[model samples]
Target: MVDKAVALLANLSTIAEGRLAIAREGGIPLLVEIVESGSRRGKENAASILLQLCLHNSKYCTLVLQEGAVPPLVALSQSGTPRAKEKV
Candidate 1:
């Protein structure tokens, strides 16, 4: 269920409005938490969503970084699937 949600949000987050809406809804922390401890697909989805949130937006990028996303993002890039690595 959570994985599905993450994936849906990931897809939606591709757009600027969706990114702002998700971030406004406090989705960043949830995405980070999933990156930290979710299943492989969930991590991928969450990371993808986060990437969208930060894409071309310095404020969101800083927000994601401040939320402690760097470590897990680095870890995912090193050990996650190719899709996940691409998202990172």
Candidate 2:
């Protein structure tokens, strides 16, 4: 269920409105948490959503950083599934 939701969010984050909505709805911390400890596929999708949120948007990047996403992202980059590493 969580993986499906994260995947949906990943797809949604590709659009401007979805990015804004996710940020406005306080989804950053949740994404960060998922990246930190979710299933492999969940981490991949969550990281993808976060990357989408940060793309060409310093505000969202800062929000992601402020939510303490970096450490988990770094960890994922090193040890997560291949797709997860790509997302990170």
Candidate 3:
């Protein structure tokens, strides 16, 4: 169920409105937590959602960074599943 929700957010995060909405809803920390400890699919989806949330958006990029997303994201980049690493 969490994985599905993460995947939904991942898909929705492709657009600015969805990204901001997700962020405003406190999705960033949740997604980061999932990326750090959720199941394989959940981690992948979370990483994808976060990537979309931060990519090419300076404000959100800074926001996620300030939220301490980088270390776990970097860990995922190194040790996560192939799909999760691909997203990272």
Alpha-carbon RMSD, candidate 3 = 1.1
Residue-pair clashes per prediction, in order, are 0, 0, 0
**Candidate 3's residue-wise lDDT over 11-85, tens digit each?**
889888889899888888888889888998999999888888778587877887887888988999999999999
Model 1 accuracy (lDDT, Cα): 0.90
Worst 10 residues of 1 by lDDT: 49-58
Superior candidate under lDDT, 1 versus 3: 1
What is the per-residue lDDT of model 2 for residues 1-88, given as tens digits with 9 covering 90 to 100? Answer: 9999988998899999999999999999999999999999999999999989888589999999999999999999999988888878
Candidate 2 off by > 4 Å:
none
Lowest lDDT sum, 10 consecutive residues, model 2, at: 48-57
Question: Which segments of candidate 3 are over 4 A away from where they belong?
Answer: none
- What lDDT does the true structure give each of the candidates? 0.90, 0.92, 0.86
Candidate 1: where is the Cα deviation over 4 Å?
A: none
Between candidates 1 and 3, the TM-score winner: 1
Q: How much is the lDDT of residue 49 in candidate 1?
A: 87
Ranking by TM-score: 2, 1, 3
TM-score, one value per model: 0.94, 0.96, 0.91
